[model samples]
Target: MYQQNGEEIFVIDGHVHLWDATEENIDHRGGEEFIQCFYDYHTTFTPEDRQWDLDEYRKYGPDRMVDDLFATAAADMAIFQPTYLTDFYTEGFNTTEQNAELAAEYPERFVLNGTFDPRDGDEGLEYLDELHDKYDIPGVKLYTAEWRGDSKGWRLDDEEAFEFLEKCLELGIENIHAHKGPTIRPLNRDAFDVGDIDDAASSFPELNFIVEHVGLPRLDDFCWIGTQESNVYGGLAVAAPFAQNRPGKFSEILSELLWWLGEDRVLFGSDYAIWNPDWLVEEVLEAELTQEHRAEYGVEWDVETKKKVMGENIADLYDIDIEAKRETFRNDDISQEFGLEDHYASGDPAPADD
Candidate 1:
């Protein structure tokens, strides 16, 4: 939590991963390329002082992740979005099993989200059942462009995909976080297109389709779809960090999102490890639209809007009572151990090294 102008803001990092891309785990050239791609994004947007070396970037481990997000970063709670690239990594890049370990130890600070590939057929459906039985996941992350043997990609509107989505509804999983952003090598660029989301979202009104990266490089299409569909949401993982290097573009994208989807539907995500939440949270709070841009778009980037984007919107989606959660944190042993009590009570920033 962060205190600003005497108001406490609860933050939920809606996208994070506990991934392993060490040289030993690299199964093929694709694995190396994937990590390199992420490194490019990290170096491009991250400040020099906050950047990590290649060794640390490959496998930062759960200890560093926990400290960066919960103890040091301003995130009150985070949701783990698993990405399992079994073809790229020997033991799957980041599986639900791995994230579940961290969530089990610190239940209050994390929400474990699982994943499934429709291409897996019957075996995949059974796996989903087993995963729900073990983790009781509220959501699942789908990477459409993930390579699988001879196949290049699959669409959300496919018959197999619908079957998996129906099973998710039956098992009480409502949120579907789909990666519809930029494309990497070994996958067709069109596979990352956001067009398929329109069909799936319209077909499944009961489920929430949160488009990860908000269909970047195709923002216009996403904004149009978001305007037409009520269940479609925008996840700001890849898009949020642009505020630092490309403020004008970021402002335009944010304004357009608010103009189309309204304030309640936009969710904050640091896409942690690529970029930490501490600075991203601060940047969002401090970011402002120029007078000309505000007049042109007819959008207001105010304090209340900042609060909703930072955490309130996602907290509402997850059925979390913000004040109650804040009270719980106030009395938590971890808070006292980390001196969060003094930091919050005095309205001073959390110590950088603490």
Candidate 2:
């Protein structure tokens, strides 16, 4: 799980979340939007300690999970989203307030990515403007896996959504995190197949949408989408299946992805808070976990490609200025900039002298 033991290499964790009732922005709200309606929230495969209930979730007390996420030094930067919109929060809730609060509390540890729900119409755009204009959120996350494709016979690239896409383009922001193409049977829903990427990328050349995960079962087609469009991109954030399915073939597929999307285009995401850090990072590091992959997957893990997938790609894509931004955050010095040191365990939180 520790990628490096000494060096303070900057890391950018692409996906993570923060929710505390005590916090200013994450407080209760009433709205008729997807994010808002899930107020009575609880994770599936419920924890053994107690049942899952959004109403009762806070009653257990604000968990230390988000703090753990912030305290961990391995993740130098994290862009997280709420687990979902529930009754506790509103659909119109923009990350601006959350990031502003986080930036004030633990600025260096947190980053912002705006949410877009087409169902809310102009209210969504107004919230997005507040996030971008006031909070400086660099990218947007569209949850097609959950919020979208609800109407009868609606395609992923519907006209209304495309208009929202134009609003994003006008805003000069398109680092979109789209949960595309999960297997239908897996979620047991009318799944949006892999071909959806092709349609979106073809129609919108101005947007920069990074299809999170490899789109499972439709990896080849998704890769093709990354191949054919300059605006299209892909990340191996949830690439564990690819590794377990054909561990030997990881290099081949990853290398092919490198060839198609170029190294900088492929991103890295932990999707943590929901998933374990050790497990997620290891999953991400799976494909290139061995020496044999230099030829098969190109370069090695912890080298340039890892940098690209994990941090560099997104930084460049989003034009993020970490150092400049860090000055304004609350805990720029609580942990080592980056390294394997037990920043939390030690009193000084310093790397070892020897």
Candidate 3:
């Protein structure tokens, strides 16, 4: 329900999660660590809801979670980069055949991203090459915090993750998204305070790394970091549930990031499976985007800037060519299964709801 200069506008959240780890699908492997990511992420999402035991996931609706993400991202369509955790995987957060299946099954809409953890060692590098050369993923995702006791959260300065970024730069994949874990403790509270990986960025000048979540007190620092590093960016997501209960608390971060980093380096994200899209979208729609500096970014207004933060910029970064992809998707059979024709097939939170 957003429009700009009479041009209807919506969002394409760059980040989202979808995992139905029930019994029926535990063996399904529709998503790998992506499954663990959801259950571990939501304290209340439940052992039953989080269990990757196939039979149970189907009961909750396996198709619902992922379908809802696509339905919400772009009303017409969406593009996604799957998230992962490395602890369970023997070889690291390897992109499973399930991920490839999703990407292949919905080529125009899904973009697969693989995770590289230092724990995997040199084998991780070899796996990365497969993602780069064989699979053609646009970026690498890593979480720099102790989530679910994952020691893989080692800082990029630790040399392993840093070396991984250097290789990412060499491979021509400039974008990297890091989840500094939760702002809450026991998981990765301090990791969020650990600001910009300057040493790594300085080493790999060509790489662009985006850190999601302001992570408590480091909000302002994160803004400055994004401003300083041409490759550094910040995104907003799962912070939704928090905002929903207390509204303006998050608006402070939204306004500050916009004030400090400007919208160019700011991106949109919905931590699906953890929080609903409706949670943030409602707040985002209500949050002020207008300002005298609107012209500074070359857009006619702030709404257009939002569009860039949400989808356009990401599409451009991956060289996704959404328009072209849209055209291709239109004639293909897959679009019918995933888009407008069946948009309401799965239940998605209404955009206006909290």
Candidate 4:
């Protein structure tokens, strides 16, 4: 929790990953490249002092993640969105099981989101059912660009994909987080297109579709779709850092999202270890769209809007009672350990270059 201008903000990092990208997990060059790519993203946007070394970035694990997000970063809750790249890593990159382990250990702090591949058909559906029963996840993250045997990727509008979505509705998992951001090597760019979300959102009006990274390079298309579909939302994972590195671009993005989807549909996400939530959360709270920019986009960035983006919106999505949860968090062990008497004064230590 962070206090700004006498108002407390309950932050919920809407997108994060707990992954194993160590040298031992690499099955091929793609595995190494994938993590390196994430490292590049980290270095590109991260402040010089906050950056981590390659080794530390590879396996920061749960302790550091928990400390960074909850104890230090002022995040009241975090949602784990897994990205399983089995073809690239021998043990798969960030499986639901790994995320669930963290959620199980710290049940109050994390929300575990499972994943499913449409290509797996009925078997995958059964696996999803088992995951729901075991973990009782409220959402699922879809990486359309994940590489399978020979197939490059699949779309949300695919027949098999629709079947899984229907199952999600039946199982009471209404939140669908889709990765429609930048593409990596071996995964076709077209595979990451946001077009499929249009059809899927239209078909499954009962479910909510959050396009992670806000469809990034394809923001225009995403904004258009979001304007038309009431259930579609924008997840600011990779894009949130721009509030520091490129405030102008961040302003533009926020304006577009507000103009199209409104404040209720835009959620804050740190994307975690790729970029820590502490700085991103602070930056977002302080940043604002200029009057000129707001006039141009016909949208305003007010305190209430920022509050919703920071936590309330996501809390509503996951059925979290913000006030009730905040009360519990204030008395939690992590909060006490961090000596959060002064919420504005972050107790987190600086990252050590290992």
Candidate 5:
């Protein structure tokens, strides 16, 4: 929880990952290119003093991750969204199993989500079942553009993809987080297109389709779809950092989202490893909308809106109780390890007098 103007804002970072892009993990050239691409994004937005060298960026391990997110108490909780690029990495890039190692250690501080590719067929369905049985994942991070065999990508509305969606519903996985944003290395630009989301979101009313990165470069299209599909949501991973170096763009993008999806549907994310929540959270919380943008979009970046976007909305989606979490964090292993028991204690309710 972050104290802004004496108000306790429980921050739940909606997107995060523990990935390995070391040379040894590279099974193909694309693996190398992918990490390089990620590095470029990191350097572009991150503060110079905060940026990590290519070596540390490739793999930071679990201890560093714990300290980065919880040590400073920048984020109260975080959700791990796996990106499995098995073809690129020898052991696969940021698979559910990899993230589970961290989540298992600090279960109260993390929400571990699984992943699936429709191309895997029956084996994929079984794996989904296995993930549910093992971790009871409430969501799945999807890479529609991930290359598999000769096929460049798959569409969410495809028949095979529908089978996976149905299986998700059957297994009680309701949150469908799709990577719909700027093109990344080894990922086809056309594959990240937002058109397919329209049908998928419409067809699956019971499920929540969270379009990560808010379909940047295609924000207008995404906003249009979001307007029509009430179940659709936007995750601000790539866009949130704009508050640091691109304040105007952040204001514009956030205004567009609020105008289209309203405050309740926009979720905050640092896209950790790509960007850390520690500083990024501060930048976002302090950012204000320009007068022109406010007049043009009729949206306010007020405290109430900030509370919802920063954590409350995603908390609602994940069924996390903020007050309850605060109580647990008061003495949890992470708090004791980081000496942050006092931090969580600050959010505790006052005693009732006789």
Candidate 6:
């Protein structure tokens, strides 16, 4: 929980992962390149003192992840958005099974979403079923840009992709999170295209489409599509770190999102390990829209909007009762471990200083 103007803001990091890029896990040269690329991004945005060395970045494991996210009470909850690049890693980069290690132990602290690859055909459908049956996943994190054999990737609007979408509808999986961020190594740039989302979102109005990274470098395309589809949303992961070092760009990006998609459609995320929420949350919460941006965009990054972006909007999607969770957290295992019982004792504002 984040305290601002004496008000407690329950934060739900909307995008996160528990991945392995260890040398032992690397199968192809692409695996090495991939983690390096991610490290570049990490160092680019992260503060010098807070940055982790490349060796630690490859595989931070689950225990350290738990401490980083919760010990300081930076984020109230987080979602596990898996990225399975099996073609690169021997086992997998970050599979549903791998993430479940921590999610299962602290079910109340995390929402684990599964993934699907349309290229697998019938077996892919079966795998999706298996994930849903075993985990009862309420959502899926898709990596359309992931590689498999000779094929580079698939599109969200592909017929095979639609088949998987239909199955999701059948199984009552409603949240569809797609990675439309910057291109990573071994993945085709065209594969991360945001155009497919326009058709997919229209075709499945029953499901909610959360475009991760807000299709950076393609923000306009995504914003146009977002305007047409009522259920389309923006997940701020790669963009959120900008508040730390690129405040101007962050203001512009967030202003455009607010102008085009409105406050209810934008969600905050730290993309953990890549950027720790402990400090990232404070930077973002404290950031302000520039005077020029506020004037031109006619939008305010106010406390109310911050509340929605930080947690309320996502809570609405995941059906999380913030108040109820606060009550439960007063004595939950995590609270006991972190000594945060006083943080959730009541929702009242802190007393004014004398």
Candidate 6: minimum summed lDDT over ten consecutive residues — where? 345-354
Clashing pairs in 6: none
When summed lDDT is taken over every stretch of 10 residues in candidate 2, the lowest stretch is 37-46
* Candidate 4 global TM-score: 0.94
Candidate 5 lDDT, 91-139, residue by residue in tens: 9989999999999999999999998899999999999999999999999
- Candidate 6, 281-306: lDDT as tens digits: 99999999999999999999998899
Residue pairs in steric clash, candidate 5? none
Q: Candidate 5: count the clashes.
A: 0
Please write out the lDDT profile of model 2 over residues 1-354, one tens digit for every residue: 135444233467776655443233343432232222223222321233433344433322213544444445445667765334433344223334554565545555566677666666788778777777876666777666443234222334777677677777788777767776442222444455556667777777777778876665567777778778787777665553345445656666676677667877877665553343433444455445446656545655555556567666777777666444433333245444333235433332223212
lDDT of 1 by residue, 249-313 (tens): 78888999999999889999988889998687777776778777899989988867777888887
Please list the C-alpha lDDT of all candidates, in the order they appear: 0.85, 0.55, 0.55, 0.87, 0.91, 0.92
Q: Give candidate 6's root-mean-square deviation (CA, Å).
A: 3.1
Off by more than 4 A, model 6: 185-189, 346-354
- TM-score of each model, in listed order: 0.95, 0.68, 0.73, 0.94, 0.97, 0.97
Give candidate 3 misplaced runs (Cα > 4 Å).
1-5, 20-62, 71-83, 86-97, 146-152, 183-189, 215-217, 240-245, 278-283, 289-301, 325-335, 338-354
